[model samples]
Target: MLKSWTAMFAAGSVISLLVVVSSTSALRGQPQPGLAVASAGSIHLALGNPSGATEDPANKDNFLVSKPQYALSYNDANGIANWVSWRLNKNDLGIQGRCKDSRGRDFFAADDSLPTGFKQIKPDEYDFPVNGFDRGHMAPSADRTANRPDNCATFLMTNMVPQRPNLNRQVWESLESDSRQLVTRNGRELYIIAGPGTKRGTIADNRVMVPASTWKVVVVLDAPELGLAGVNRNTRVIAVNMPNTKTISGNWRSYLVNVDQIEALTGLDLL
Candidate 1:
């Protein structure tokens, strides 16, 4: 089955491969088919899904959504993505810039792709004047600058979580820049997974959960063609669990952690 799936993936039948995997899982009575197999190409999630997310209505918290730019497991109850996964190569970088308004603020659009009845968070919800948080991107806007729609998709509210202004602007932003440098400078391809961890509080009148920490796992491969098959003992995996608080400061490397620790904290298997 693995060999067949690899052949199908190599043939570029990503959607067809997903259908087969889903059908086979149903017949075997396993947990609903995960999106990992569904996203096994140069598209988003070249490695695999960390959480077993599916489109099943019953699994609203871990509902899977695949976009041209990236893939994510959106948690309806929490009103944020459980995790976002994307493949980043040098070709994905461009000068398209971030989707912003005339005021130079990011255009946080509501995601209409979510099914009816799921709470669609609006942009104004993050407009707290006193103790407001920045709309942090799980998959940073800079990572998807290949085109207009690709960059615009990063601004969707589903891809956001309430992050401290300092954390988002400083340390987190630095790491995002460094990730891009890996592609531009070293010519490495990265498979990244990021999400919030441990609800710290509530925002947007309790509509959105503020996570205590933001975690990410970056799998860096020497070349884009290698994909998942390239991962080995020597593969460089950078995982960090940064606190989502104003007091946090300094380099993102200070908050470095092992992948297993991040998995234990967020309850997701990140490879």
Candidate 2:
């Protein structure tokens, strides 16, 4: 049988959908005989879909886009992702490096997969030095280096947000590196969700909204093969909420927060 739960935000507004599958067939990567898998073969959301996003064009703000590399809820009005979730394991790591364009510059391209009428953010829209924001990635490039195409998928503009230099390069990057350490060194599998919070303002001719803060939830598991069944009360969940400003701590641990706090802030039931 299939069961589900809902989490309401502190504001008494937003609600999060949590789907739980009980069948052994579902755990084995197959849908139960009568049910259909939403995004077949995509293990990125093995844990859950935080916001209940769908591919329905009418739900522009919470539109779901699933890919082999990762899955994200694209917000059309904000021109950013509501959240991006992916599963990380040692097998996903490799010697492959970041992708580049013909000129050998870092390739940040528009996601042609977005439905028509959705603005496809351009790489140059970030306006780097002038804007003082890095084209921050929700799914860090290093986390998807298993192959060329996988790594390149991370460069899609839809997976990016405007982030301050200090937070992006220092604390955020450090946390990303540590997440990989859990996989490469400690032999752990992780299901991570990350996104912007509380839009502070807009950029690129008011095309993309800048968030006041950024947050992430990392659920560490003992093994990738075990998947969601491995998670329990003892699971190690690392959630962090960091301010997006010029001044911030270099250590990611300094911004640690509880998953409930993140849910209150982002209104997503991250598991």
Candidate 3:
């Protein structure tokens, strides 16, 4: 499936029915080998991008080229990601490298590098405090604090979606902390993919879609290599689907689910 998708991606412009999409030169750095593309912009994430799902040509879906820190399948019409994928390890936890600017903002401008006709969303456009939602991080910023590029990439509006405040600040935040600890305990790398289930429709002038629920798939591996060889029946896979509402409690663990369930809900091949 990955091979087929790669073939299509290599074809380029096959899915030209998109509303707007953009691409830009990658940042200057040693490219991470093995991945299909070593993002041109910043330091590439260790796990590589996820693949296997085909986009509907009628919709405004497009694969946003991977940046150094993370990669996303962006939906240009709704101005959000279908999914965001990246790698995380204990080394990414502390020691702030030069990923942010002096003004304390993301090094990359919101959607600045997207393809030419794509409708880019800005960071402050969410109006979180006024809109009663948070500009939630699909690839969380706190998890990539180890350096500037990785951390700053998480702030891109392309990596954000409208999330309820309680879910973003409380339960979701706690779960993120736990994920880091899980890596520290096992001493391995984790590949994570997260996105929204936007059954609830849009918010804030219909600019950002409101997901009825948000979901995540975490693949724990002792090494970094593509394919199902590393993941088996016994492989540790964590999947969670949390409601997009204010009633969620602080315990994110309570929302745990199986990877199979997430795959069914998302219609994406995670492995």
Candidate 4:
């Protein structure tokens, strides 16, 4: 049977100030290596030029270049590989690091939120509410236990937000499932990084190259043989966002956002 692939995850990112959202990078971490990592700031979270992020071509939209961040073992519960101190770099953050086992099973605890070196951010202090925000994922659920509990720390209130239930469960989730399956089925692996982006100006749902809350799940497949497209030796990018379910109607349609032709608008040399 020519089976199809599937990937699943919610669409949204919200939580308290103490939260550690994983909406930007791939799911590659080294918490087992005992390295201290912290949540990204607004500039760090910017997708276009704020943070100077790269891109992923496999998934729906070209997103970012996520990387693995690790640390030595911390506590015995996390079963960390080491506890020695280390440092995580830029390649270790944002929509480039949202993949499966290719990354670590656990995410980092806050530098201030009680020594998060391979330490799981237990939800004891913070409450994870269903109506509050979307279950912002760190290490991709596929990388953890089926229920995303192997590294329960990654599922903290700091890494979540309010997301649309339908889109989260429908198109977006399908993308996640398909990505992971592409790895197992093809004997390869896929890396992904997802999250939110805000445009420079605000106009009440102003449309930009990247939309807010679109739950931009930037996926990066390692092997080129997974029948993948939208990428190249350098980088191919996709920038899809969550649908505005609040106003989405069947009678709606989207087309090119310009009056001039492609050459006129971009002013590029096509001839």
Candidate 5:
């Protein structure tokens, strides 16, 4: 139905299809075609795709939500000021997971994750008691609590990459705070898509990195009240890729713009 409608109706609808569903790692010199710059978080970008023709990584259809909350980080240099541990779920799953099957490797396998999202897998058959890479998290513990594992399951080793201690302990913690704040503010459930980094092809030398280098994390916030529309109407989306810079430095697409400029850019009544 959706495919036929776009084929029959809008011409622009075509490009919108693939871009809506894909989340690429940081690109070299291009901002994602349809995203806008967001002001909040270490990185921010978002867009509206009412069609639902494309599948989102964080889309609820592909995943389920569990206890996602923030818990305080014991390693916070700032002490009690650092209250984190938002989403808490184990990555390694038992047998019978949707993506797991005894015949194949586990999607959340620590040292032995099979090719996930491509096929079905079982738990016992997974590369368990594995080693090498950390059980990384797409949705860090800084964002969830003791809840359902499906949503938390999405944050498993498959979506994890070995992050640096400083990045996780301090920097990413900040990003976590912002993520929780938004979900709290929305009052409506938000969908989050996250996955682990792979070390197979071009990144042959790279392990599932624990510390985020270049810090190209991205955040997308929607809902009229956020004032996102005021920025760049063409891209009511925020885009910023990890810069590959040594110190993990970057800013939001909205960092340079003010609320007024955003209002002008989007022509929305953001003020």
Candidate 6:
């Protein structure tokens, strides 16, 4: 079943049809023809297909998978995602009195449904309490609290990468916090895509890949308020590329970059 589904994804039939459904249902205004859209389980989010990158590895090998909160392009060989995409909105956060996954598990776990020959990454692969690396979240847990299931889904190991402790706990965490604030302050929805810029290296007993840096691309829009028509040259886009090392300062905003810069580094076209 999974193989066949991935085959369809490679043929572009599954996600193409899904894009049409997402564009029609999620947007209040007309979406430009042939824009890239990603599905977060049932929710469809828009990506304006920013130009500059020659290609996106996520669309390769049919490993793109969608959960209720985010979509990731898994690289089974490297045991990490090339990118994870998700939709962020006003209602996506702030679950009063609920602060964590109700399952009582704070650890990252394997995704069993992944295709054969791909070993499920373990929670301890991040070298916690030893090498000082953290299992950093790409699609942050804070942004997926629309429901408990949504929040828990973000804990999948595939959505994580090995990050330095200081970078993860300080700067990276700040960026995740800012994403939610951006939505609340603007009164709109945001589309986010994030991933690692990896070098030829491995960490944690060679089980996990080490990212040279981490990057994210965000497209801000007043969706359902201004709709797809709101996306234009003037649309506010925030792109950040931060070092994966411990030397990163407390301010994540210091790494602010343009979408083109991120595209050039990751070979991904993100708007």
The model with the greatest TM-score is: 2
Q: How close is candidate 4 to the true structure, as a TM-score?
A: 0.37
Q: What CA RMSD would candidate 5 show?
A: 16.0
For each candidate in the order shown, give its overall lDDT on alpha carbons.
Answer: 0.76, 0.81, 0.64, 0.28, 0.28, 0.64
Local lDDT at 144 for model 4: 36
Q: How well does candidate 6 match the true structure in TM-score terms? A: 0.76
lDDT of 4 by residue, 91-120 (tens): 222333322343664343332232323233
Q: How well does candidate 2 match the true structure in TM-score terms?
A: 0.87
Error of 5 at 114 (Å): 3.4
Give the better candidate number (2 or 6) by TM-score: 2
TM values, all candidates: 0.84, 0.87, 0.74, 0.37, 0.34, 0.76
Stretches of candidate 5 off by over 4 Å are: 1-135, 142-146, 151-155, 186-271
Judging by TM-score, tell me the better candidate of 3 and 6.
6
| Candidate 1 per-residue C-alpha lDDT over 1-271 given as tens digits, one digit per residue, 9 for 90 to 100 | 1112221111111111222231222222122344344544325644555676777667889888888888888999999999998888988898998898789987889999998889899988887575579889989999988888889999999999889988999998998999899999999998788999999998877889999999887767775675655544345667788999889899887887766578689877564
lDDT by residue (121-192, candidate 6, tens digit) is: 887777678777788899887887777677777778988888888888898888787778878786768778
After superposition, which runs of candidate 3 have C-alpha atoms over 4 Å from their true positions? 1-59, 97-108, 223-232
Q: Which ranges in model 4 have alpha carbons more than 4 Å from their true place?
A: 1-133, 136-139, 146-150, 199-212, 217-219, 222-239, 244-271
Model 5 vs. true fold: TM:
0.34
What candidate 1 gets wrong by more than 4 Å, as runs, is: 1-42, 102-104
On lDDT, the leading prediction is 2
Model 4 global lDDT (CA atoms, 0 to 1): 0.28
Clashes of 2: 0
lDDT of 2 at 72: 89
Question: Of models 1 and 4, which has the larger lDDT?
Answer: 1
